[model samples]
Target chain A: MILINGQPENRIPVSDRGLQYGDGLFETLAFRNGELELLEQHIMRLQRGCKRINLSFQHVDSLRAELAMLCAQTAEDSVIKIILTRGSGGRGYKAPLENEAIRIISSHSMPEYPEANQSGVTVRLCEQRLGLNPTLAGLKHLNRLEQVLARSEWDDRTISEGLMLNINENLIEGTMSNLFIVKNQQLLTPALTQAGIAGIMRSKVMEIADSMSIACHEKALTVNDLLDADEVFLTNSIIKLWPVKTLLHNDTNTHWQHGALTQQIQNALKDLAH
Target chain B: MILINGQPENRIPVSDRGLQYGDGLFETLAFRNGELELLEQHIMRLQRGCKRINLSFQHVDSLRAELAMLCAQTAEDSVIKIILTRGSGGRGYKAPLENEAIRIISSHSMPEYPEANQSGVTVRLCEQRLGLNPTLAGLKHLNRLEQVLARSEWDDRTISEGLMLNINENLIEGTMSNLFIVKNQQLLTPALTQAGIAGIMRSKVMEIADSMSIACHEKALTVNDLLDADEVFLTNSIIKLWPVKTLLHNDTNTHWQHGALTQQIQNALKDLAH
Candidate 1:
C-alpha cells in the first residue's frame, strides 16, 4: 500500500515535478525485524537532498511516523522506498509557490542477495560515464538517469554490479553503491567532488573505520588503483556491504576474492542497525 | 485539464518509474495558429529519447490526439508539454516487464514570450555546471537536477536565462535552452557530444541558417568563446530564440547589442510557427 500524507492512497498527481523534471529526492532502506534501519541517516540525506534542489525540508516527523506504521504492517524482509518531491510544480523549471506533500511508499518484498556475498560478487565497468557536478553531489536526489543508464549497460544477472567512471575517467562508484578499497590496510574511496551518490552505508563504513582504528581516506582514485587494490567491496543501505570477487572491464575479467574485513564491516552495520 | 490514456485524470500511480528512477522522456513544443510548431521533430526526439532509455515508444495515437486537442483548445499562441514514462515499474532500477502500457501526460498553457523580444534579455552565468553523460546527453530525459539547480541560482525574472558550463569549464547550454553564438559572421553552437540537450528550436535555427545562407557550425565552445562572441542567444521551443543584451559573468558585466542575424533567426521561427 502507498502512503500519501500519512494516509494509504495509491495516487500521486501526474503533474508531479518528481516525474517531470525529476525534481525530487528518494530514500530506500531495509525495513527488517520491525524497525526502519538507519532511519536518522535516511532522513538526514533526504533533508540535504531537498535543500540541494531548493525544496522545503519540513514535516519530516509526519512522514517518519508513517514509515514506522507501514513497516509495522509488513510480514517479511522488505525494501521500503520514501520519495519526497516538490510535488506539482508549474509547467516550467521554476518551482511552485506551494509545494506538494511528501510521498511515503512501502513495499513488502526484496530480491534475494547474491549467494556470492561471502565469496565476493562479480562486477563490470560501465560504458556510461557520470558528469561532475559538486553542487548535487552526495545527495540522493531523484534525478537518476545516470544510474539507470549505467545499470542498463548489460543484462547479465551474474554481474553483481557495475562500476561507473566520470567524464575525467576517475572511478566514481557502482551503479547504486559506493566503492571502497583496501591497499596495505589503508581504506580508500573515491572523492565525491565530481559525481556519484555518496551512499549512507559508505558514510557508516567510514565511521566504522575511524572507530576500529582502520586507516580510511576519501580521495580520488582511478581505475588503475582499483585494479591493483588487494581488496574491493561495494556498499549501500539496502545491501549493507558485499565483497567484489571479480572485475569485468570491457568484457574482460579480473579476480578479487572476498577479503577478511568484508564480514567485519557487514557485522558493523548490523550492530548499528539493531 | 489533464490527459492520461486519452482521459482526464490528475492522478498517476505512485510506482511510475518516471518518478522512481526518472525512467522517462518528455517534449515541449510551441503552439501557434492551432498547430504544434515542429511537432514531427519533437516526436522524433521523444522517440530517440525512449530508445536511448530502452523504453518502447508506445501509445502514439492517444498522446498525439490529446496533445493536438489541447493545442487546438488553446488560444492563438500556447505551449504544450508531453510526458512519456516507463509506466509504473516496481521500486527498483530494473526495467519493468514488457506489455506495460505507456503513460502519456499532456498539459497546455499560454506561451511566455516576453513583450521585448527585440530588446534582448539579460543572461547570468549559473554557478552550477552540467555533468557529462553521453549516453543520456541530448535526449530530453527526466533526469534534470542540474537544470533545476541552475535555475534556482536566480529568482529575478528579468534575467532571461542562466548560462551553464560543464565541469571542464566549457560552456554547454542554458539552464533550460540550447546556446548559440556568432563570431565574425560565423555561428557556432556547442556540440552535444558529452552534455546539454539538443533542443528542437536550436535544430530548426540550424535549418533556417542553412536555408538563409548563414554559417552555422556545432562545435565545442568555451566560456572564453562566449565572452568574445559578436552575439549570443538562447533557443527553446516556447521562446523560439532570445538574444542576450548583457551577460553577468561572475558578477562582471559584458554588453553586446542584439545582432542582425540573431533577430533574423528569431523572425524566421516566428514566421514558420505562425
Candidate 2:
C-alpha cells in the first residue's frame, strides 16, 4: 500500500524534482509484529538529511501520524519507506522560491531471506567506486546512483552484499548496509566523512556496543584491513546483522569464522529489535 | 506538454527507481523556430549515458520519431527534456531482472533572459564542492543532488551562475554549464574525466575552434587559472555561450572584458543555432 501526501495514490507528477534531479531524501524502517523498529531514529535521520540538503520539509508530525495509521492496518512483518521531495517545479535546476514538499509513504512485505543468512553470508567487493563529497556524506539522500550501480555489479544469488570503496581506494560501505570489522577484540567501522550512508542500524549497533562496554571506533579502512580482520559483519534496517563468512575479491576468497564478538553483537542487536 | 512512454501523461508510479534511487539519465535540448537544436547530438549523448550506466534503453528510434512529432505540432520556441528511467521496481537496490525503461518527454516555454546577458554576465564561486568519481562523471545522469546543492548556495538575481570545484579544489564546471578559459590566445577547458558534465555546446565550441585554427586543450584547471585568464565563458545547449565579465570570489571581484575569442566562438555558435 502507498500513501502520497496522506492520500491513497501510487503516482506522482513527472516534474517532481525527486524524479527530475533526485532532489529528495528517504528513510526505510522495519515494521515487525505490531511495532515499527527505530522509528524515531529513522525520523531523526530524515530530518537531518533534509537540513543538510536545505530541503524545506515541514511534514514531520503528519508523516509520523500517517506512518502510524499505515502500520496499524498492517498485520505482518513489513518494510515502511518514506520519501520527501521538493515537489513539482518548472524546467530548471534552480529550485522554486516558494515550494511545498511532497511526502510519499509506502509499505511492502518483508523480504524472506534464508535462515542461514543470519549465521553467515558471503559478500563481494564492487568495481564501482563511490564519489567522495564531505558535504553530502553520511546523509541518506535520494542521490543513490552509486549504490544502484554497485549493486548491479553481480547477480550471484549466493553472494549476499557488495562492499564499495571510494575513488581513493578506501573501503566505505556495503551496497545496502554498513560494514564493521573486529580486530583484537575491538570494533571498527569506516568513518563516513567522505562517502556512504550513515545507516540507522549502524548507529544503533554502535550504541549497543557502547552500553555493553565494548570499544568501537570509526576509522578509514581498506580491503586489506577487512581481509585481515578477526571477524566481519554488515548491518542495515532490513538485514539486522549478517556475519560475513567469505569475501570474494579478484577470484580470491578470504574467509572468517563468525567470531565471539560478532555473535555477542548480533545477540545484542536481536534483543534491541524485539 | 508532456508525453510519458509515448502517451500524454505527466505522472509516474511512486515505485519508479528514478524517484527512489535516481536510477536514470536525462537530456535537455532547446527548440527554436520550429526546430530542435542539436537533436541528434542530444540523442547521442543520451544513448552514451544509457550505455555508461548499463541501462537497457531500446527506444532511441521511437524516441526520435516522437520528438519529431512533438516538434511538428508545436510552432513556438521552447525547451525539450527527455528522461529515461529503469522504471518501477520492488523495494530494493537490486534492479529488476527484466526491466522495462520509462521515457518521459516534456516541453516548456523558453526562459526570458535579459538581452544584456549575451554580452557578459556575473558569476560566483560556490562553496559546495563536487565529489570525485570517474565512473559516473561526464554523463548527464539523474543523480544531480550535488549540482542542485551548489545551485542553492546563492539566490542572487544578478549572478547568472555559480562555478563548482571538486573536493580537491580543481575547477570543474558551472552549476548548469561547462567552463572554458582563454590565456595567451589559447583556449583551455577542464577535462571531465573526473567530474563535470561534457556539455554538447562545449564540444561544438571546441570543434569550431579547431576548424578555425585556434589552439584549444583539455587540462586540469584551477581558480587562479580562471582569474588570470584574458577571457572566460560558460556553455550549455540552452545558453549557447555566456562570457564571464566578473567573477565574485570571497568578496573579491575579478573582472574581464568580453574578449575577441569569446565573441568569435559566440558568433560561430549563433550561426549553428539558426
Q: TM-score, each model?
A: 0.93, 0.98
What tens-digit string does per-residue lDDT give for candidate 1 at A1-274?
6787788988787777888888888888887776778889888888777766778867887887788788778878788888888887654777765674467576748778766665688889998888877777877888887887777777777888889898889999998899999888879999997788888889899999999999899998999999999899999877888888899886678887677776677677775553
Candidate maximizing TM-score: 2
> B-chain TM-score, every candidate?
0.94, 0.97
Q: Give lDDT tens digits, candidate 2, residues A79-171.
A: 999999999873377887667678899999888888999989999999999998898999988889999888888898899999999998999
Clashing pairs in 1: A131-B132
Name model 2 segments beyond 4 Å from true.
none
- Candidate 2 residue-wise lDDT, B1-274, digit = tens: 7888888898999999999999999998898867788888888888888888888878788898888877876789888999999998744898886675688998888788778989999999999998998998899999899988888878878999999999889999999999999999999999989888999999898999999999999999999999899999999988899999999988899999999999999999985552
* Residue B81 miss distance in model 1 (angstroms): 0.6
Residue B180, candidate 2: Cα error in Å is 1.0
- Interface Cα root-mean-square deviation for all models: 1.5, 0.7
Error of 2 at A96 (Å): 2.3
